[model samples]
Target chain A: MKNEWPLWEVFIRGQHGLSHRHFGSLHAPDAEMAIKNARDVYTRRNEGVSIWVVEAVNVSASSPEDKGAFYEPSNSKVYRHPTFFDIPDEVGSM
Target chain B: MDKDLFQYLLRLGDNTLVLGHRVSEWCGHAPVLEEDIALANTALDLIGQTQLWLGLAAEVEGAGRDADKLAMLRDIWGFRNLLLVELPNGDFGRTLMRQFLFDAWQVINLGRLMKSSDPRVAEIAAKASKEAAYHVERSADTVVGLGDGTAESHARMQAALEYLWPYVGEMFVGDDVDAALVAAGVVPDPASLREEYDAFVGRIFATATLEMPESRFTHKGGKNGAFHTEHLGHMLCSMQWLQRAYPGASW
Candidate 1:
């Protein structure tokens, strides 16, 4: 419909220190209603400690043609892996 | 047995049970998907509260009937919900308007109940109060938004407010039952809640830019079990049909 409510992307933080992860999207008339809708749609099962909603129109996405530039380059960077580091016995599980 | 307390708990449980069912009727029929989910969530919260309230009521009655039995097996006169709650959900705006009116009263009533002399009553009130507070906030915000929005929405919300206004009084009309509860400190007199309800609703109406109806006339009798609007009987037929058809059925 031409007058449909705007779509909003929802992000939910599962715990106090956790970063919010994208959960889903829903339509709302405004930012406030978007948050309320996200709470109802995403957090009913104790799924989140917090929520964030962004308008779908305001999100910037990389195009499929730019996938190599945006993502493929990172696949070959073995030096970027933190797994190569060794810890002293005194440093324990770190 | 405390007959007055049992009656009061039925009033509490039945309000949530009936209103929850009414809200659930919008499950797949709301104006939009998000709203459908939101309304369903509201209904679920009310139904959860119903379980608590009615469970306690059943215990107080010392009868074999449980919450499910009290909720599903009861006839119209057995219900003690406010007439406001049992009224049909006219439209989306009207449903929310009815919700707002009920939630406003419930938030205050539950707030007072948190300090009830009956410990079980206090415990249920504490949990239900949180949900009622959230319900009133969302419903009030929607009322203001729709009441002050485009001409069409504003007009519809105004009409909704007018239609639901008279029913609001039934929530605060105290009688002998309230007197006994008040004497025992189990509940505050319903009449005492009027000033706060008016102030809260007045501020909301002012912000919504919707005029409150000037008339003070109220239709009563639902909560006392003296009478109910025809809507409650029709609602029970659908709600109770499954249990009626297959007695003691459960999933």
Candidate 2:
């Protein structure tokens, strides 16, 4: 029997998001199924208007053990924040 | 207060309630987590539709009954649901096949019902048609997927189609309950819907790559208030337990 359907990582672009954001993962036989599953799983409550699915195996990840060296160094860089820039009220909501 | 209109509403309402209840049976038993939720979603729609149809049916009955009482307290013989909805869910394939067939007909039926002379019938049919449209798409897609999948999947779907095809006939069997309603323009004749139903179901079957069975024999009598299946009794046993145990309990 063909068991253990592959896992797919789902991404959704809601009414508020400009880009798709990772929502969750589900098991399916193929990309089509992953899309359907994603809709049923993530969008059942009108959560998103668009969806993207990637096979879990295709996604590469850095080791969690390297968090201190990989991500922590970026935490020290507050200059990346848009708040660091001076903007007049004329810029409006931005 | 028209008995014919009341009977028509029961036929419509019971189909949704019974089928909704059947779909709800998949709450935690679907093949996958997504399906469990999807089927449950379908169930919720059916239940809501049931409330609308049965609630109106109660208003027509004029015996001081509500939707809850009409739904929970009725004896099996009093129910007017089509046999197809009351049949047990055999597997995911069977469940979906049954849904596709029913939705195919429902979408058309409700579309016509929207134009009903009676304001209430038209109102309910309008909302239901929209949901039925979505259901047709979802179930049709699933049918294509399962029918064209692996050999095992294809075989299972074919079996489901063949097994349930017989019950589909009952959806269109018309008698006095349908006659008066059709004459009054409260509802469309079930016979008139056959061609359209077959066309939609045929198209889906083609895309799914499944061959249509040659069986001409069909099971009927769901709308006649006499169900020949044991499935409804068992289903109602659990469905009515709480209502029977506590006459007026509320959550």
Candidate 3:
């Protein structure tokens, strides 16, 4: 049998209208099975009302090895910090 | 005789206890770790239900007996659980099939019992029904997954269905205790719920690309005081040994 099915990342919403939070991942034969496996794996305690499963191969992310270059520059951008502004007393009171 | 009520409660309690014990056997042996945890968690839930029901049974008996005494002291013949639960967990598929059938029945049965005239029974049933619902859903999902996933899984699931199908009849076989409860509105007729259970299971099987096994020989003995299966003895031995060895000992 072909073992080429992609890994899927599972995200679950705890209750209605909630955003799906990452739960875990599982290997599945297809998108449908991915969702079903997610339900079995993630929602056994009635912990979720909704689930979203995306193939892991389809997701792109910055490499951890590049975190220094990708994130350190942003950390030193002081103007981007909202705390740099002093609010007027009237605005603070409001 | 009120002993009848104790007997009735024992039947309910033993079914949960024995089945919980069987499911617990899969704690680390399940096909996957997630499923192992799920089955173990469900086993704990069933054991909790067993404790509550057995405690209530002790109260109703007025025998100065507690749940532990009743669970651990009784002989196998005194146990009144349906045979379905005592049947060994044959394989992963078989176990899932057994859980699927029992959980579905329990959800319906417990739902009706929540309206029971007895306040204690109703309260426990209400709480248990929620847990039972989750068990049913998870098992149903497994049945669907195995039935449709791979050719090997489909065959295993079908064989499991055949092995478990005979035992399903005993679940809705209303004994005198059940009849009285039904008459008193303490529980709905198990027979009435059978159709709904079948339809629900049928839908899942249909979607899973599996055929529901045709009802053939109905095995009827566990509730009527017959024990032909081998699993229950070991289960009872392990479950009852501690309490029996140290009678009246408690933390």
CAPRI verdict on model 2? medium
What residue pairs are clashing in model 2? none
User: What are the interface RMSDs of all the models?
Assistant: 0.7, 1.5, 3.6
Across residues B115-161, which tens digit of lDDT does each residue of candidate 1 receive? 99999999999999999988998999999989988899999999998
Candidates by TM-score, descending order: 1, 2, 3
List model 2 lDDT by residue over B149-199, tens digit each.
889889999999999999888777888878888888888998899888888
Rank order by lDDT, top first? Answer: 1, 2, 3
Measured by TM-score, the strongest candidate is 1
Candidate 1 scores an fnat of 0.88
* DockQ-sorted candidate list, best first: 1, 2, 3
Clash-forming residue pairs, model 1: none
Candidate closer to the true structure by lDDT (higher is better), 1 or 3:
1
State the lDDT at B239 in candidate 1: 97
